[model samples]
Target: MCFRLSAEGTVLSVNRYGAEHLGYERNELVGQSLLRVVHEEDRPSVSRRLAECVVVPDTTTAWEFRKVRKDGSVLWVRERARAMTKPNGEAVLLVVCDDVTERKEVEQHLLEQRAQLRDLRLELSLAEQRERRRIGAGLHDSVGQDLAFARMKLRELEAETLASETRRCVEAIGQHLDEAIRATRTLTFELTSPILYELGLEAAIRNLVDRMGAQDTIRFTVRSSGSDETLPEDLNVILYRACAELLLNVRKHARCSEVEVAIECTEEGIRISVQDDGAGFDAGGAGKGSDRTGGYGLFSIREELQPLGGRFEVDSEPGRGTRAVIVAPRERTAIADAR
Candidate 1:
């Protein structure tokens, strides 16, 4: 609906649609102050805008404000207006308004839904982390302890003088038991690193790289700087997990024989980069989850860092190797509270 108003905000004329929209007759609104229909709380701003429009008659301005209807109900309206001079040389405004109450309500509902989803994701992620810690503890305390005890008993049996054939069998059994114990420890560490909780991110990562290097499948090197500063526990976990996932991807998919893991603290935050000399896939395809070797590890890493206000990036080309970078903030209290 369109209307004209005097420079002072008196309604010069309003179309029938405009009058009916406000639940008033055109004649009744014609001489009324435009502020009479604007919601009281918005009147000051509307007044200032109108004064500005008069002074800058060539420019158009738009705003959204609440308007009071004849029965005292309020609804949102979007106004587009520009100043003009009447034939009589008096300044006026040609204003167009549209009822936008429904649109605003929809937008608000969408925002609320997005917030709910974010909260749900955070709760689920935290719960998953707790479950992993529980399983890791069980493996270390229960299964690992049992294996160690059995190995000790085998050693005791070996200490006794026995027939040559039986002694040989006992030695074999002891070796197998030792392997089982090592396997259990590796599994336990993979599930969760206690060092992450007790020491910090740097120690946990160092331990991870050390373990990987011990396997002799791939040569791993770690170069770190400025890692002594304390970080939020959750942020530390996220960065550590991101690094772990990327390294695992390198070991599994990158055909390279060597990998480099670098950790550095900067003025902004901490950065962890994992680089592999392995046969790399197309970075674009990896990001899109289209590369057969890419799997979902990189995507998972990205999702993990997003909530901490961190960033994840991958650079690679076929045969050029891949580099995964994870960055986390120095101060994460506000980010943690947002969760």
Candidate 2:
């Protein structure tokens, strides 16, 4: 479609195809202002482009905007326009337009699909956290209580005057119960820590580092800056899990003995870093499920964080060190509350 417009944007002539496509007769558009067919919101920009053409004669300008047809339907168009001088020296705009509605619709559709996927991922992560909390609570309240009661009864029996051999047997059983109780507590923490829900991400991370450090020869340290008062409950759970996964990877792969986890709240959002001075691997080729790192765990964290306006990054090299950082916006989005 093509049109010839005067310097003031009045249509002097229009191609038959362009006029008919807009549901107008050639004579109907000849004396009409071209802005009549431009979408209201796009008219201002169209005017500016016209001025640019007049000021820079022969320079072509390209842009995309919506145009309205005679029947009030809208269509996207990619227009290329240039200013030219007629034999009388009057300035005129020569414009060509191509329909781009299909491309625009496809782009919008892809955006909606991406949003749906992000919502689905966040929903799944929340559901998993709920389940873990339920199981952790059950272990702490039910089976843990039962074991503690049994141990108390066995101790009471031992206190009674009995044969030394019988007393020794009771003490042995009590010892076994003690170990079972400790194991249950550790398992509960592993599933989901109450600290994460109660004290926020910082304290929960400190507790996690302490617990994991106690179980291994590695030294773990936690440093926190900025206030976590604005961190949402759901984010706390997600970030805590990511940190745990990164630390686990360090324990399983990094041969270094010292690891540091730092949490800071900055202008952008919350930043969490876990650095391990251990056997590092080539991080360049680490894909979704790489054995060098936590593989699926790292991949999953990246996927989960993206939906929350967050990112997971890893920097490492052979014999150097591994630094894993999780950066997330402090605000919990509407999707996080959808469930």
Candidate 3:
């Protein structure tokens, strides 16, 4: 059990573990600020963090310090917190506090090994993406075959319909069934592009965007001279998602009926530009969910693209339309193809 407290040296709640760990009787620290037990040097930082957290929401922060026990011994604690608004309309902060001094020391010792796995590296990620692509392809090959079989059977059933109207109805049903299978195929590829495995990421993007263009009224294009296109998995995922989000926005918004997508692999890294000749708006305004189509398309696009040390450029004028560019790193494994 953990302890909870108000910012002011008053404890609000204490769980069994907290009481036992602190050598405190059940009544001792209740209704206390809990910070009283925090080491003196750590107090100011703790206070500053608490003050900063008040206005921010869903932010995470952690601080480590020693706490004085009832027996006069000190134990270290790592406290992490987030700002919250309680049901009583009271301003409150929820905290997950732990005695992590020992664990932190152990983690510090193993940092080198752990960093390789937990921290995402671009080149390594691309290799992983290729693997995922392979897996996705295998799934599609196996499941897709089954879907084809089912579709074939459905078509045979449709052929048995004798009456014209009944045959028409059966045909409609078959059409829908085919469409469902197609949707599943799209999902399988979207989940992991086999193209990245067989065709590589660059060609995969070209194929995906080209297919999208063929299906919609959007005018799409890819710009690149040298096609040495290999990006690390982390970067590839970001690039792919950035492109996907941009196209989705155009499809749903940029009512201009035209879109252009460009990919450039430069010495510094990779950059993708997606433009739409549709209605644009002020990028400065708030996009809270107020019937604005979930109000998160652009935000998601930025978040997905930015983490790979990439830069996203947006150029849009209300009448002129919108353009977005994302720049990041490039890897090896360069090969190109048309789908």
Instruction: Rank candidates, lDDT, best first.
Output: 2, 1, 3
lDDT, model 2: 0.88
Alpha carbon lDDT of residue 200, candidate 1? 87
lDDT (tens digit, per residue) of candidate 2 on 109-162: 999898788778878888888899999999999999999999888878987999
- RMSD of candidate 3 to the true fold? 14.8
Badly placed stretches (over 4 Å) of model 2 are 1-19, 22-67, 70-72, 77-98, 254-257, 266-269, 277-296, 314-320, 333-337
Per-model TM against the reference: 0.66, 0.73, 0.49
Better of 1 and 2 by lDDT: 2
Quick one: best TM-score, which candidate? 2
Model 1 lDDT tens row, 1-339: 788999999999999999998999999989889999999999999999999999999799999999999999988999999999878888999999999999999998998787566546655666667788899999889999999999999899999999999999999999999999989987878788899998988889899999888876899998989864578777776677668777777777789998998889877789888898888887886655555435546666665566666778889889988888888788776445655
State the local distance difference test value for candidate 3: 0.67
TM-score for candidate 3: 0.49
lDDT of 1: 0.83
Comparing 2 with 3 on lDDT, the higher-scoring candidate is 2
- In model 3, the Cα lDDT at residue 119 comes to 32
Segments in model 3 whose C-alpha atoms lie over 4 Å from true places: 1-139, 149-180, 286-296, 331-339
Better of 2 and 3 by TM-score: 2
